[model samples]
Target: MTLVNTMEYNKDDLLDKVQEDAENLFRSGTYFCSEAVLQTINELLGKPYDENIVKLASGFPIGMGKAQCLCGAVSGGQMGLGIVYGRVEGEPMKDKMFDVSKKLHDYIIDEYKSTCCRVITRKWQGDDFKSPERKEHCITITGMVARWVANELIEDNKIQVGR
Candidate 1:
């Protein structure tokens, strides 16, 4: 698996499906951070859940409705992990879920020092929420979080890139 550490990922359909695709959705102004993450992963997984699944991620945007605690992208990515690694109620817990979930959190913390939405976007708090700079910053993180999750799925052999 070509992990993201190499900064090398296939520029194939997987890129379109995960990172760039989600970025576009967020840039379109309809989908927010968490929604874009869930939407892109849903598409990549062949829509295991229906369109309404996106609502699960809606509350996470702007750090749980602008509470600015957790990073919405990270929260959304965790939901993506749940979709992949979570088991049925009667089944045993998947061991990999905790590990992967923490890894996702680590990814954000390692890069930005904290996964809190306020911390990550601290520089842009004074700007208008719809300002291009603010939007671009969130958009970039949205793409990065999606790409990181996609890379994890690929490395763990959970999902194929193109599929």
Candidate 2:
């Protein structure tokens, strides 16, 4: 559904709704890790998940595969936060973006209990050789991270919460 139509909120209620929507997005997907995150951001922000955001975030999974640092899902969550609260030139509200991003990151880390990619992927990591389990794990983790970030943003009053 379009966020504008689906969203109903006063200033106090937006975050909870956004977090709920984010969790719903994650649970609904079997795959679509990156796309689902982008979609969640759009829904939470009451914007559209257009091609540009997708293209910019396309490199996330590749980065995860190469860097082997944080999980791609977590990266996707960070990217979504950046997209919604990112700083821009001449924007008087730029400082808020950093605080918001930090809060989101901290919340995800706390919720997941670990930020290490290997740790997060440990459950699905195996020598199966071409098993789809790894991808599924990544997708699930992505959803979790998305939910946490959405929750933080909402709770922190960084975004408009919806009913």
Q: Model 1: residues >4 Å from true position, as ranges?
A: 1-13, 161-163
Q: Which candidate is the best by TM-score?
A: 1
C-alpha lDDT of all candidate models, in order: 0.82, 0.59
How many pairs of residues collide in model 2?
A: 5
Question: What's the true lDDT of residue 152 in model 1?
Answer: 85
Write the residue-wise lDDT of candidate 2 on 1-163 in tens digits. 2465334565434444444454455456422455566667666666645645655555555235545566556667777877767756886666767776676567657866666666666665564313467655655566566666666666666565444
Off by over 4 Å in 2: 1-32, 90-93, 128-136, 156-163
Candidate 2 lands at a TM-score of: 0.66
Candidate 1 lDDT, tens digit per residue, 19-71?
88889889997689999888887767667898889899999988999898898
- Write down the worst ten-residue block by lDDT for model 1: 1-10
Predicted model with the maximum lDDT: 1
